[model samples]
Target: MSSLELCYPQLLNWSCRGLECLHSEAVLLYTLFSSIAVITVALNLLVIISISHFRHLQTPPNLLLLALAISDLLVGLLVMPVESMRIIESCWLLGDIMCSLSFFLSFTLTSASVGIIVLISIDRIVAINYPLQYINVCVCRVCVCVCVCWGCSFLYNGLILKDNFSLRDRHCNGECIVVNNYVSEAVDIVVTFIGPCSVIIVLYTRVFTVVVSQTHSMNSHITAGTGCKVKATKSQRKAAGILGIVILVYLFTFCPYYYPSLAGENNLQVLGIVTWLLYLNSCLNQLMYVFLYPWFKKAIKFIATLKILEQNSSHANML
Candidate 1:
């Protein structure tokens, strides 16, 4: 009786309880998750500032990046803190309304991020395979694409989780769990993971194939005649490789969630750690920007030093 009372205080039948943990472990978890939340917010905010404030950085590719950065930033800002509390507590203390809203926002932001990356894959393919045609990708057109990506994400996720968003309890007490029928579960995985990932992979393959062909052609031309030059420059090829790494990192972080879905199991079963890994993609995207792009680094330096406050700062060369 005492043990039962210890495990289930108040004798409530439906309330969920978390696994017992030492106080030190709980404190350590809270600290670690808090630090991750801070880093995700700060890194994405840097990307947002770098791209938005600088005119020179306002190209089609960078515009796609800006949209991605915005999605990731919201993940850090709106999603991570609530997620951290849920993880640390291992229970939902927040009421039903908040739970549904939080999950809706989470689903929307994650889908938006994935959709932007799909657009990025296509953009990189065009840039690498057809440089002249790439310039035809106008800013207005890219803006339209971005809007479509976000709109699709909102609509798709809303349809999938429509039940949860209806201002009712999430069908659980002391738990914020997602429940889906067999068909919706399968549809969700196919649309969110398998479909987009397959497109990204195929697009990246075409890009790398073009890249290698261009590199070999350039090398042969250099051997034959010093004056001969290829359409794809050395620097552009390097940038393509670097950006490939960034996308690969995003895939590595995101693709693990597919496992539980594949196994036909509850996401909540392995969700705690997997979800955090997913959130870390938000930070890694910005960190890769800092590492790969010299212009981005310069922009960061300028902003950090407050030189951005000076007159005509936006006109300064970022590239």
Candidate 2:
């Protein structure tokens, strides 16, 4: 075999096999992943800034979004590049410790992202369904919940992949894999995917139902120059609709990643494609924000033009 066919030719038989890609394919994949990662970071950063810097934009729902953006931003910043290299090289060039760290980071971020989405769904439901008491859901409470989600994610992944910390357990010199026992993997899939996704879907469905009813109520009450409250209702409905789309897209991208757990087979090749597909969801998430939220676009303009750097800029009416 040619030296080029091995990830590290000098290691001879011990080297992991390299991915066979033509020059065009390599360029395309590199460009694609790099572009996605950059876009994901930039877009999510816009969200974080828009919500965090603007005092009025720091509502309970937006706080949840801020947390979600933070996780997504980390995905673009940390996980995508490593995963892309792992795919392109078809080998783990990083040592066992780095590999363990990579898996831990990836799992924690993905779990926290999903948890934040669930929180967002619940927030929307409460806002639309119980508008009078929505004020009761204060920013501090939301912040606490976000903290708990992140903490749990870190602890959960650490416990699940505890065995990976032992470098001697690694199967080969050029392979990076997280080994969870069958019971743990099963529980992880159910808790991470099945349970959270079910709650997300159910909450979104109820939120949409309430939104439709509110829309109809507003339509029946619309009168000459008294449509101000009605307009707010429409905005709420639109937010719900956009977030529903976000949840659907999240599920679509993530379903493949859990296919191994679903089929009860752990195939490395299949896991590679699906895990990247999962990471791509982070990139797509910010794009959804761009298309759905005018505030995001406005914030991007402000951020890009150095307007945000000005004193009292946080008071700008982004709504």
Candidate 3:
């Protein structure tokens, strides 16, 4: 018999055996991942709510944070549930339409989220570099940039769906894979990986340069005026340290996920872990903003106090 024929039957047998294993372990993995997913969902949702409910949190950067929270919450709410079910079932039961929709939303939201991070870096750099010009140039610009990022992301992923929707088999795997379209695969590589990654790298590079320059200027000013060069230097170092951590986390979590996909192998396991880590990024932003930036911390504390007061008032009214 030919190798193709020999492999076909073996593939079927292995698939069947895999299905049996999937059934046995489904509940365990589902419980574990579902728990993580639930926590992630709650965290992102809380971020959105906290930011929205608090007026002080409505700064330009916090606005961007709110957008990130929304995207991450959608990922946790819409995508993760289906993903958990798929893990339990070990098969794509939602049909090709849902499969396509899921992939499209996941890709678009993820891309937009990364794009927003890049925008946030740029916003910070500009604010630091041209502090006097910040108000003039910064207002309404972040919103416009966010809209453009989301629109382009949807357009890019929509094209992928348009081209490959008919070819997908409802009975096949739940994951999005362009089975026969090498061109679609190539587009995914360029647009998804190379495009946003290049922008992120360049933006952060500029941001680092601007921050270092500002720190040097501040050090010089403090030395000449306040005679507290030591304190100024320490502050500069602290700012730089925080920015470095943010950049490192972004690269570590996101690069591993997309770089591998660019190389043409869709290792779903790696992809899943990376996706989970990326979702973790949204949650991490709350920590970063609150701890690394004083303004955000103040805003959060104020919101918490307000909530506490509201609860007390409600109890008194009930009494």
Score each candidate by Cα lDDT.
0.81, 0.86, 0.65
lDDT digits (tens) for residues 1-319 of candidate 3: 1111221243453322223334437677787777767776766766676666655556686788788878877877887777666544544546667777777777778788777777777776666566578777643887898899899889877877675577764333433443436777777767766776677677667767766776677766664556565564455456556656777777776777766556765776676677667656655655665567665555455456775257433222110
Which pairs of residues clash in candidate 2, taking residues 3 or more apart in a chain or in different chains?
A: none
How does each model score on TM-score? Answer: 0.91, 0.90, 0.77
Query: On a 0 to 1 TM-score scale, where does candidate 3 land against the true structure?
Result: 0.77
Best by lDDT: 2
Off by over 4 Å in 2: 1-24, 167-170, 217-229, 265-267
Across 1-319, the per-residue lDDT of candidate 1 in tens digits comes to 0111222345376566565556787789889888877888888887878888889899998999999999998998899989888776655768787888898899899999999999998888888778789878899999999999999999998898887766355354666766567888889889988899889888888877888887787777675454435544666677678768977887888877777777765656387788888888988898888888888889989988999999999899989
RMSD of 2: 2.6
| Model 3 stretches astray by more than 4 angstroms | 1-18, 22-24, 169-180, 221-243, 264-271, 290-319
lDDT, model 1: 0.81
Distance from true location, Cα of 121 in model 3, Å: 1.4
Residue 130's lDDT within candidate 3 is: 66
Q: Could you say which candidate leads in TM-score?
A: 1
The best-first sequence of candidates by TM-score reads 1, 2, 3
Clashes of 3: 0
